[model samples]
Target chain A: MKINPEFVTSVITKFIREELNKFGFNRAVLGLSGGLDSTVCAFLAVRALGQDNVLTLIMPYGQTFPQDVEDAKAVVSLLQCRAMIIDIQPMVDAYFHRYPTDNPVLKGNKMARERMAILYDFSAREKALILGTSNKTELLIGYGTIHGDMACGLNPIGDLYKTQIRQLAIWLGVPEKIRNKVPTAGLWPGQTDEGEIGLTYEEIDKILFELVDLRRSRQEVIASGFDPKKVNLVWEMIKRSEFKRRMPPIIKLSSRTVGHDFLYPYDWDK
Target chain B: MKVVLVQFSPHLGLLDKNLDLHYQFIDRALEEKADLIIFPELSLTGYTLKDLISEVALNPRKNNQLNRLKSYSHKIDIVVGIVEEGNPGLFYNSAVYYSKGEILAIHRKVFLPTFGLFEEGKFFATGRNFKTFPTPFGQVGLLICRDFLHYGASYCLLAGKADLIIILSAAPGRGMSENSGFTSSEMWELMGAAISRFSTAFVLYCNRVGFEDGVVFAGGSFIYDPWGKCLLRGPDIEPAFLSLELELEDLRRARKTWSFLRDDKPEIILNSLQNLLAKNED
Candidate 1:
């Protein structure tokens, strides 16, 4: 389905402002990775909370590409917001030296966690709420490092698919260089999201629009000119990554446990 | 008949701004060649108006606020919700149907919910009439918000030979089902399906979105055919407009297959109700 970018921008900005006001905070902090998703989130945060109230923390590991850091700095300068870059190599090296591993997956997860650890520290120091950057596609397929890039006080782009993000980014007047660049987690060199996920975002978004929004069945999707293997693969990813979308399940020993039979809303007082 | 169901977020207590939006939606509908366009309850003024009800009430004679819409109805039929001024002190939550530069029918809300989050009964007078009027397509019935929640209202419309039932609601989104989401929207969908099938009439439900005083309106507007088949559905929690071409023949086909209206015994129902009222009085 086509979306009206003007309408979406107004509603999102209003939502961010209203939600922050309800929580009695006006400042927001976000990790600016120079990727499309984080750039879009930062843009919305700046619009909602103003440039003075927004702070972008550009934390990069030793292995991160220099071009990515430059792109992040360009965004900060364009928005005219406060920014700080903390080289995360020392922190990551300290931990990896104690628990040495040759696996890239382990190293990637460690770097992600280290960036988040520094982000939370700045969040506390600056008294700003942490904004999230993960999009719906990555969250659905478990492509993100949980408790790292996924941790945030609130997320503005989590509901938007990767294709929708591109549409919104252009509408929000995000720089074309960052918007047109390849999508990546920046966890390692030469790593791209679509390559690892084995599907183009255009192909996946259409399938996801049918699967998640329309709630179509697998056979229905396959019958609609989609390959059976891709449909099955995407469906499996969504099902398996369901845990990443929710809170940790609590063992309910009592009748009313948190997130169980008895529950209260977060804004009960307000 | 081609129909358009609109689900929009109205700014509370802003008549001029809301009318501008109404005109825009109407123009869009005209471009789509829609025969009829329906909007949510309180289309002119958002819901959750605690004390501003009287301030936003429109007088039928004095208020020319809807003249543009009435003129636009020369090419399309328009059904919208507005707060109406009755007497010096009486106001009503009402639905107005306009066609061919004239007000065809007005259905004041019969059920004014007062408990819980709703305070409509406290500020507005209840309607005493349930009627249907003729349109270019067929006989059409109108209900506002809580009126469609009561079964008797739909029965009255059916008894009046209405082939199309239109309801406007500002229902809030509440409760998430384990597998699905937005239970209230699902309930409204079920109501639309059942009413359309049982009465052998097309049902159109339009609900609004947006937040007012912390209450969020759930927007899942839809249009259903006589056989309980949904033709179009609006998005939830977002402002949306949907246009669909409906086959008027479906009413006749569904009635012929089921014959529910032909076998209906309204006289028996009226007599039983009268007898029960007499016994209660004695």
Candidate 2:
């Protein structure tokens, strides 16, 4: 479908406000990596809950780029929201030192999880909900850490594609430098999302729009001029990552299962 | 005529909170100068009230909770879904039309879906009739959620000379087609547009959003002109308010151009149904 940036932003801003209000929360918090997704989320949160109620945290590992940190600071300055920096190197390094591994993927997952741990502590202290910044493209193919970047009290941009997020970010007055920069999770040096995913967001979003949103068969997608191998590869990624999107399955011994038949309102007591 | 669709998620079993939100939306609609505002199915209570259905059931005459809503309707027309409490324990899933501080019409949902995720048939009594009432805008017809899915419901309203049809839905979104976004949302758009085109009447759809007992209602509230052109559309998963300026001339033009209603078919349908029912009885 054709996405209207203005309409999407307004809807997202209202969603953030209403969802948070339903949960009795007036404050919002998220890790700002100076990336397009976080920048857009921060801008929307400020619009929804106001600058005073939003808190942005910039957690940097030892291998983090200086420009990313500078960009995160610039975003806070522009948004006029409260921001703080916490060096996660000690926490990540302490764990790695005990285990001693050369694998960058393990280190990346640990770094991401460590940042979430710090964000949650701050969320408790400040009485705020952790706002997630993972976009639809990253979430669908398991491009993010499950218990790390995927955890959130509420997510404003989870449904939006990465390309759509950039459009929204530009519409929401995100700095040009941030919008134009290559997308990255800031997990490791020279690690771009597209480079790791093995496909450009524009291509992947089109494929996803056709395959998932359009509900076209895999053969149909392949017949639509896309490489059959590429289409099948994307389909496989979605199938494998299904577990990341759902809660743990319970043994259904009884008639009503916990997540199946047995369900309760999340705010039942409230 | 101007119509405003208030597409907000109502928390299950939260009567006070839902009523307060409705009041706020009413105030906002008045500020926007809407002639009528419509809410989703069971807006007062919620869609998934399995065992708690009777606990929050409202009686139009005695329930003081609706007093404020009645007062507001004096200024602008109001259409909302409610669990209508009747004769002690009897209850119904109904849509009430309020204007000038009076209950103009109440359309109890005729179709009580029992299959799949719906258990409405077990909770509320089925409605017996479908009616089009006189409104400041024009003759208007009302249908609740699944009621709109049945073609017979709309045919009755068309036969009654209704120029507008309002449907209140609490439908959960399903299926994500690659090009269409949400399959459920697109299906609704197609239905609303097709009904408006064939019936030559305006179609207003108001669906709720938010999670209720793990079921997320798709909020793609929209308004379509008689020509099947969408005037305004809302988001698929967010609470939104859409106010559109609807002129009666659109209906007049479509009816004049197509005259589908003028062709006549109710008598044929009535005769055919009789024969079909008689054969089934054997």
Candidate 3:
């Protein structure tokens, strides 16, 4: 499932440019988490709409990794795009202080949504479209907050798996530090994506490439030399996370409903 | 004969805007003095039109826009894809071959791909016939994207003595290859080559480029000669209006050399199919 990174890069940059142009926007805003996915998107966005047109928002919570923040800053400096450090700690903590949630997942989800809110705010202020950074792996497993990191005006890397994103990141000449780092959501201290997902992206991507892209059955994927439990887990995750990949289904009462018979393309008439 | 392939991205559900875009390209083709101009499937109404298909469906018999497009055929033979409203509620994904201010032929797409990312079967009525019409270049056959994938469709055209097969597609770009191009695009090229070589017909594929709800159409429109040699290829994921001078003499030479058409036994195959169908029914 390896991709021609150069071919993919050209397609994505053109996609970003044309999609944004269709919406009459020359500028784009994306949250930079110092992760490979976001970093690659930043590079592509800068390539499509000049460095001056792309804005990077580095929003870190109180427990966010310092190295990640540094890496994010490094990328912003490297790309020479507009960068803003908006600490989401106060807003997330303020909400938690009022709501009183001790659960890490709840806190993490709050942090993600807070960052999304700030990104949109900046998007409105800058009149730039918010570019999504969630890769296919995260999207398939529903590892992202529904309306948080998942919310964006356009996504250039949603079809690419985590492994493919790493491949693309390497081709894009992303920093070795950023490329080699363990993938994480940076929601809490000492948290890694593989740890939470119960499998490495390498393993997850293989199973997903079969189960999703190739449309292989769980048994067929296991037969292809994957661990049965992991294959089953990946299949289950894909099935369970279907909601995260789509709009909320509207109950159709009228002849033409928004998400039903009244379907139109997102770029319709624009 | 010179052929111009207008590889363009149509604004989804915007008929008038896409018409304007078509006119722009048509004018360009005319300026180049091309004999034929081909556009990708649903050139007037962008692909991925789910419910919007009905909104954009054109009755070619009476539509003013279609009439205007047909008017250009007086100057150059134009082949364009459109949402053809055959009857009141029945629509077909169709390719119209316009020549001399009249539609010479309308090939409704036989294979309406409904599975995977496509929902054409849901919106369009499946076409029944595979017919070829005479063109100034040669006898030509038209097939939409999915129709071209079914070898039987090409075979039917070959049987109809088609010397040129034009495929109009809004094929979504998918499957990355380790090498230079998309896996989906490679499949098209492979099929185009095989069909061209076997049928001894020039295969022209015109595919659109642009994102429709995140599914981007691969715009690697290409032309294959009668000998299955690629003459021209448009850029992937980008809009291009490419013109190619096709040596019509190549068709005569390839046909004489291979003689696949001359050595064909359609009668035996037809009899075999009829017997098989009769037996199956029994």
As a whole number from 0 to 100, the lDDT of residue A180 in candidate 1 is: 93
The C-alpha RMSD of each candidate to the native structure, in angstroms, is 11.9, 5.5, 1.7
Please give, for residues B1-282, the per-residue lDDT of candidate 1 as tens digits.
Answer: 789988987867778888899999999998898999998998897777756777788976567878888898898999988988978678889999989988999899999999876777877899999998999989999988788888889998888778999999999875433323366778889888888888999999999987665556778888888888888888777788888888998888899898888888889889988999989956
A1-270, model 3: which lDDT tens digit per residue? 888999999889988988888888999999999989999999999989999999999888754488889999999999999998988888877887889977888888888899999999998999999999999889999989999899999889999999999899889999999999998887678888899889999999988888888888888888879999898888888889899999898888997788887767677775
RMSD of 3: 1.7
- What candidate 2 gets wrong by more than 4 Å, as runs, is A255-257, A267-270, B1-12, B17-39, B47-55, B58-79, B84-92, B97-106, B110-140, B160-166, B169-263, B272-282
Give the TM-score (vs. native) of candidate 3. 0.96
Pairs that collide in candidate 2 are: A209-B178, A213-B177, A213-B178, A214-B177, A214-B178, A214-B179, A215-B177, A215-B178
Number of the top-ranking candidate, with DockQ as the measure:
3
- Across residues B109-183, which tens digit of lDDT does each residue of candidate 2 receive? 999989877888978898999999999888999999888888889889988777889999999865533333356
The top-ranked prediction according to lDDT is: 3
Ranking by DockQ: 3, 2, 1
Clashes of each: 0, 8, 0
**Candidate 1 clashing pairs?**
none
Listing candidates in order, what is each one's chain A TM-score?
Answer: 0.97, 0.96, 0.98
TM-score: which is higher, 2 or 3? 3
Q: In candidate 2 chain B, where is summed lDDT lowest over 10 consecutive residues? A: B174-183
